[model samples]
Target: MSQAPQTAQQPVILTGDRPTGPLHLGHFVGSLRSRVELQHTHRQHVLLADTQAMTDNAHDPDKVRRNVLEVALDYLAVGIDPALTTIAVQSHLPALAELTLLYLNFVTVARLERNPTIKEEIHARGFGRDIPAGFLCYPVAQAADITGFKAQVVPVGEDQAPLIEQTNEIVRRINRQVDAELLPEAQALIPEMGRLPGIDGKAKMSKSLGNSIPLSSTADEITHAVKQMYTDPNHLRASDPGTVEGNVVFTYLDVFDPRKEEVEALKDHYRRGGLGDMVVKRRLEEVLQNLLAPIRERRTQLAADPGYVFGILREGTRKSQDITQATLDEVRGALGTFSFDRS
Candidate 1:
């Protein structure tokens, strides 16, 4: 599903996690792994998108602030080097807010409502007719986040294509209006494992849904979550033939297990009967533990040094601010007479 634009040189990349909670395995498989790999080949900027998180969680500012460090730990634990990738806090970049305000003029409320990602998220949040204006306008802010860095590549799940498309539309509209290519049209780099289903067999893994296994979960927690994971409901006995298509356990194994042959064999055994749920659960538990153990260890070490983690974020924010200021200057200069200074 990954689609990188053809280019002679490496393109600047912008990607991020909403700092509302600790990142989960869904984040790991979807974007974090690719980001770690992409940093070596591209100019990367990873945002702790607190402002975007606040679009929905506006009532809990403290929760957002606390999770900023938690999300940063997850990034560093998973090998996202700040030296290679600028990891910036979204709220610190004031220029993004200004850019969002300006970009709002180019798009209409109807267009925002039609953004598939926003629409899906609003329904997921159960906002219905009471959707927050900030939540509705998040696409414009996202456009600012991408263009402020002049990012040409944005790694995201397939569901987020609408956001990238919306950003590019704004980029095209602004370019045509000003007779200048003021911003780059960022491309979406969708991962092969685009979305991970929840452990409860839900369509998507979400923190609010209480089905996600957090990246920072301990070995015991991992085991517990796996034990409760939903498998075929009709396969009630160990001797009963089981289905793997909709089984969350097999789904996770398919994504996380390196030994494809082993997983396939296990699937065959289960389908033929005699392979109990406990057997499959134990194997999955082992696979997940092996995958996450090192990450947890690294996260523990990084957590002990809070100053170093925050120091990385502070330095990154400064670097991002410089880039954003340059973009804002160009955007303001193009509009003529509107002055929004970073000072």
Candidate 2:
């Protein structure tokens, strides 16, 4: 409906994860690490997506709370500096919820069913007979998250392009419905390397599926996880030819290991029937250790200051609150919901 946001002078980026569990290597490789880089260049807003978490995990509030700190730690652990980015709780922002209510009127239930991400997640989570209403309306909430900040750049994995499409559709419909450009049309920033699949060779790394490698994993945990990492499943022995074409191990290398030549070398060796899974797994472990060491150390240091993480969230919430309230006022004014009891 609008021109794809090709470029902006330091465009605002809003992206984040649901605090369903501790963040894993999947998050770091897929998006968090990129957020750290973008914070310096783009106006960044990293949401602690608690409300989204509640959509599916509503029955398990404790699970959500436990992971709230876990997700924040992962954000800090992965170097998303709070000073550079706004990191706030999704539920804490009233404007987001307010906007979600307004946007829901514009989207049909059939349209939400057509949303690819929601469909995939429902099948994956297997919420067949009793899909929660909260879960059903999450895309409207997501539209709220994006437009509440008026973000222009939302980094999405290849699979999540539909979300941007859904968000922009809301933007267009809302502009037409309200006779105002109250919301901004956002573009998907798909990274050069898309989502990394699970170590178990599933489509994606996820907590429910139990394929993720946590950012806080011990060296031994990393070792075991790596040793068991799925390679060419049919390659039974060292002498048997292996395939790296769809192997998750090679997928990790393509995303994490910067030494492309070495990965290619290893791939060649495997296809030639001499490379053992252990050799490649060990190499992956080493690569991950180097990558995660600083994050772990920083997490340890930050853990010492529990108050600090909360302070960051509180401050970010306050700052986000101001802008969101103003936007809500305009939206409410358009809908004739703004009034004061000055009597």
Model 2 spans > 4 angstroms off: 1-9, 341-343
Clashing pairs in 2: none
TM-score of each: 0.93, 0.91
The alpha-carbon deviation from the true structure for residue 59 of candidate 1, after best TM-score superposition, in angstroms, is 1.0
Query: In candidate 1, which residue ranges exceed 4 Å CA deviation?
Result: 1-8, 338-343
What is the overall TM-score of model 2 with all chains considered together? Answer: 0.91
Provide the lowest-lDDT 10-residue window in model 2.
1-10
Writing each residue's lDDT as its tens digit, candidate 2 over 230-283 gives: 888799998899999888888888788999999999999999998888888888
Candidate 1 lDDT, 274-343, residue by residue in tens: 9999999999999999999999999999999999999999999999999898898898888674565532
Return the TM-score for candidate 1, rounded to 2 decimals.
0.93
